[model samples]
Target: MKAKFLLPILIAALALGAVQAWAQAAVGAPAPSFTLTDTKGAAHALADFAGKPVVLEWTNPECPFVKKHYGAKNMQALQAKYVAQGAVWLSVCSSAPGKQGHYPADEWNRILAEQGSAATALLLDPDGQVGLAYGAKTTPHLFVIDAAGTLVYDGAIDDNPSTDSADIPGARAYVAEALDAVLAGAPVPVAQTKPYGCSVKY
Candidate 1:
């Protein structure tokens, strides 16, 4: 009887996991559309950027892995580089109201200013709807959407998953590689990889 009960629970859990995976925008598939409010109380929608490439970054200011990239200026540099090239780079935060990374609008703006963030906008996703749609599971999870609204990449920021800023110099930036390929009309070399960082607070 115990074995029978355990099997059913296992099956249910697997089904849920599968559903979550399917809900995410798959590589080569149309990027899932979303509308989110920024810290400035302005609402932005994916469709607002119809003909431009978009970069989605899952960020939490308090996560150590996030700090590793930011402290190295690695993430900020990418934001500046890509956004200057006419891509929409959006930083997303999905931490719940009482969660570790959650912060009010004023504090959020202050932090972004201090970090010199260059993303087009810092979108708030406190309800986790956008994160869940993208299957964002890590503090530094990343996604790249082509100009045609196709999701070309979904995974870690770089090849190395270390929390050391020193790793930034040596690590291959998967997001940058994919965007470069997309812009050049070439196939993305590495499409996906398991993300590594603190679990997203949902």
Candidate 2:
């Protein structure tokens, strides 16, 4: 009888823990803080970009959804446009070792260079701690933090959820909109949406 009661109690506790973990980075809340190493072997803390709008892009090069954006130079263009305006664009990879998107620092540098990435930094999160803290669920999941360090947006890169670059031109770009709102000191039109992409390989 005691064992039967304990089973349900344990399950409830586990479910509650998961909910709490995800709630840590909910939109409109303070963004979760993290320190991660970039491809250049330098550490970057979320606090380092205080007072500046920050863009967190959870990416995996092997994911077709990511390829759709990069192949069309859409992601890079967004990075350039915002970074030039004082926003920090960080492309984060949370794939674990031996996973599809996992790469050594040097390799990552090469990949970014070859792809013409304009992100301020390519942060590596092999342990997935940062990803988990931010509730990153997909390869191209995106989060936008305002100058005040409040998580203003969390969702997909755009409204379309396809692997075709051609659809990009017509889809509503959510990340860009969020950045614009944050930079202009306005509320994001859409604070959250269902992100679509490959499951984060944690």
Candidate 3:
């Protein structure tokens, strides 16, 4: 009986440790490399984009915080601008199947088309491995990896952090600022910030 009880406790502790281990990606350091499949079932690896700046956007289409940016075209505009300059913008959804924000591939493709999304790919993270590894806590948690593969920025997209589209007009777009500074050979003014939005449904 004692051995049986100890086994359960040990399992729980190991699980917690695994989560902590996966969340070690830090700013100014090499971002964790990952391989995830896009909606079309094509696998892409972070290492494949080496020598180019990359943006990892954690998104939940049904989240109001995400809607605030997309509805205002702020996110797409950012994607378009940076991608035009050779940056790879990846939109990742960590919602598990049967969850609130989860959608099938057909629905995901349709949603992208309907929303005029400009992301290079819609990565499906149904198991949430990518999100957990990045320590993404919010629906719109954003990360920017420079050409050197260093995570130059990680956090909220903007300072407003509200679910209102009107807030975009005056908010400090952190992701854009980071991208500009990194691309210009300057250090990012803000390397990290507490992200705000709906919790990523793992």
Can you give the lDDT of residue 107 in candidate 3?
A: 92
Task: Please give the ranking of all candidate structures by TM-score, highest first, separated by commas.
Answer: 2, 1, 3
lDDT of 2 by residue, 1-202 (tens): 2222533554686777843333358888899998999999999999999999999999999899999999999999999999999999999998989888999999999999988999999999988778877879997999999999999999999999999999999999999999998888888999999999999997
lDDT per model vs. reference: 0.88, 0.91, 0.89
lDDT of 3 by residue, 1-202 (tens): 1222533554676777843333668998999999989988899999999999999999999999999999999999999999999999999998878887799888999999998999999899888777877888898999999999999999999999789999998999899999999889899999999899999988
Residue 49, candidate 1: Cα error in Å is: 0.9
* Steric clashes per prediction: 0, 0, 0
User: Which of the numbered candidates is closest to the native, going by highest lDDT?
Assistant: 2
Residue 93, model 1, lDDT:
97
Identify the superior model by lDDT, candidate 2 or candidate 3: 2
Find the 10 residues in a row with the least total lDDT in model 1.
1-10
Clashing pairs in 3: none
Q: TM-score per candidate, in order?
A: 0.90, 0.92, 0.90
Model 1, runs deviating above 4 Å: 1-22
Give candidate 2's TM-score. Answer: 0.92
